[model samples]
Target: MPRKPTKGYWVRGHFVAYGSEEDSELKRAAKWDADLSKTDLKKRSAHLQAVGEQLLTLKPSLLQGLDLPPSLREALAEAKRIDDFEGRRRQLQYVGKLMRQLDDALVATIEATLAEQHRASAAQTERLHAAEHWRERLVADDAALDAWRELEPDADWQRLRALIRQARKDAQVHPDPAPGQAQRKGRAWRELFQHVRAVLDAHESPSTVARP
Candidate 1:
């Protein structure tokens, strides 16, 4: 009887037999974390599949900027359009296969892009929180204006004062709640939040202001 044939895929014209010594070396060279075994290979495949799924969620302009093969791009594009459950699973498997063919550098680029986007999303949340904090303080205390002025010396102080005054007035007037409905502050409340957000967006951070 003939010996069982090895199973693998080709990488850059070289056939990489799964879980073989050569496979382990290539993985190490690519800076992958684990020693290759049948199990590790499965984990690697699943990881690549997850990365491929993340690629599907990439913005269209960012996706276009990636240096991907035409076939992989088409597969990713098709995966987005697939509405059928089984069909998407099969298409994603195909995407995972293509992802494996990518060189180590391109894989690093994909990871970096995802990480950068994550940081950007976090910064946006932080900015919104900072704005809310300032808006609350300004509406409650006249002294908060001095702290805000120190942070943004170039801000339109008069405009901020007008918004804060109106927001405070709106906050003091309480109306009876209708059933489950909460008390809604007037437009100035919203405008105060927006104004603070604009100032915060223009600067790095309140703590980083050119402190005396």
Candidate 2:
């Protein structure tokens, strides 16, 4: 009869223990594969390229806060000068490559700066829209003046009324252009918007005297 195989059996004359060296090797291989999948070269390069493009859109004043290296700064400048489609693309690729060598913390700072700028821009847009809405309401309805006065009692009532009247008259005299023509606002209309914006801004300012 053949010898009974033990816990450490011999496979082709070499000792093969179950769940020992073989299991360790298998685990190591799996971890290596996982690491490779996570740090895919192509994916990293693409992400860096996208970040470079976003950086290009930011104003030079804003970019000064990023404190990029001299080489990277030069790369961005060169990239900006590249007007040809393919040349710009290649320059941007080079920028991405340079970016990859930068500290991760620097990248985070750049991203945060961009995010803050976007938030500020959105807030400005909201304020402009609010001003426009108030201007339109004041011009269209006489009662809107009463509501506005209640909110801003210190406002110059005479000037505000005059502006609104002129804006309305201008709108009537220069009626909307034909469908194909570009509708352009007249001077009075623009002045009314400016006056309304100033009043709203004053109300929001801390220096303005609040009602008792």
Candidate 3:
């Protein structure tokens, strides 16, 4: 008797035999597509969850403009109350699910808020660094005094000179002391930082005046 016909199907010009390599490959391709689709959805969910967590970091007053759904708003509030790591994770997941049902406008709002916060933080950091640079220059170089005087003609030059002298002396006496021990020998250095920061702040905001 002739051998039973090999089980197979045709696709285009190729015959894919059952239990053959070609048939196995076809199944794998189909499964891969399904897996890829699921993976994309998972990634979207994770991204939404991250956005929700970032929104939670903002103050409630700042969130008032977003006009978020009641369910999402409540979820964010509840997430804050959940101190447990796993519980917060679950709550955030729920928030992500809710986010999927909402429009893209909410995501855009959250991103914009975060961007503004980052810009403000960067500006504050730049101000702090400028103050620190001025402090160091005033202490280490005598000519820096003239530069500062040119910038702030109304500053109490006499008092600032005295503070700088004392600060330099204090720094020499307690060079590289432990973190909190800098004030043990004298607070002159700390006072100098405060004075420089005040001067810079006043310069940045001309309406404000540096305190004596």
Candidate 4:
């Protein structure tokens, strides 16, 4: 015989696992440990974002003094590694968008501040126009890409892409109901089940019926 499927919280901290006093205590301890880990994860995320922001600001200054205080430098270094992995890896989707805004703002700032540095009016205008044009392309491209993603979300060009394509094909072949249809069906089924249950419960009650 096939094993029956049962659903209960299998995670350590969940209430279902702690039916007894001893189990409850163990659950509490596990919860506290998980809380600590979550706290560390959040703190690391913040620290890494701070480091990335610092890198962005620092990279802009071509001839500025480079020395950070020792403690800050240590923090920055750790932040840089974490930022590189999580920020770059997970957040690459936002890079084109962010780069567009950053480039536009930087160009405007530079044009206002460094127009005199270019020596010739034509050179300054040309550079300014180029920067603005590049910024526009970046914004437009990002928007187009985002729209395309919405229409076809499986953009990951990896081994998983084939699996995703197959799943999409299967879904197209056997499409699921729209979101609310499932909920409506579920509610109707639940009502029918409850009515059946009530009938069964009433039949099992102490009231005796006559058989003619």
Each candidate: what lDDT? 0.80, 0.75, 0.76, 0.39
Select the stronger candidate by lDDT from 2 and 4: 2
* lDDT for each residue of candidate 4 in 1-212, tens digit (9 for 90 to 100): 99965444555666453365445545644654677687774564454344334343343242133333343345434444665676654443232222222323443443333333334444434444433343233223434334323323554435323433443344455556777774122332333233323332333222221110
Location of the lowest summed lDDT over 10 successive residues in candidate 2? 203-212
Candidate 1: worst 10 consecutive residues by lDDT?
A: 203-212
lDDT of 2 by residue, 186-208 (tens): 78899988776666565554223
Clashing pairs in 2: none
lDDT of 1 by residue, 37-156 (tens): 667777877888899899987777777788998989999889989999999999999998888877779998998887777776777788888788778888878888788876678878
Query: Which candidate should be chosen as best, given lDDT against the real structure?
Result: 1
As for model 4, its CA RMSD to the true structure in angstroms is 33.1
- Candidate 2 segments whose C-alpha is farther than 4 A from its true place: 1-41, 150-152, 199-212
- Backbone clashes in each candidate structure, one number apiece? 0, 0, 0, 0
Give me the runs in candidate 1 sitting further than 4 Å from their true place: 1-35, 174-183, 205-212
For candidate 3, what is the TM-score? 0.68
Candidates ranked by TM-score, best first?
1, 2, 3, 4
In the range 1-212, model 3's lDDT, one tens digit per residue, is: 99998889998988999997557657755654677687776786678777877888776567887888888899989998999999988998888767765556768888898778777676666667777787888889998888777557888888899999998898888777677663454687788888877766656552232221
State the number of backbone clashes in model 2.
Answer: 0
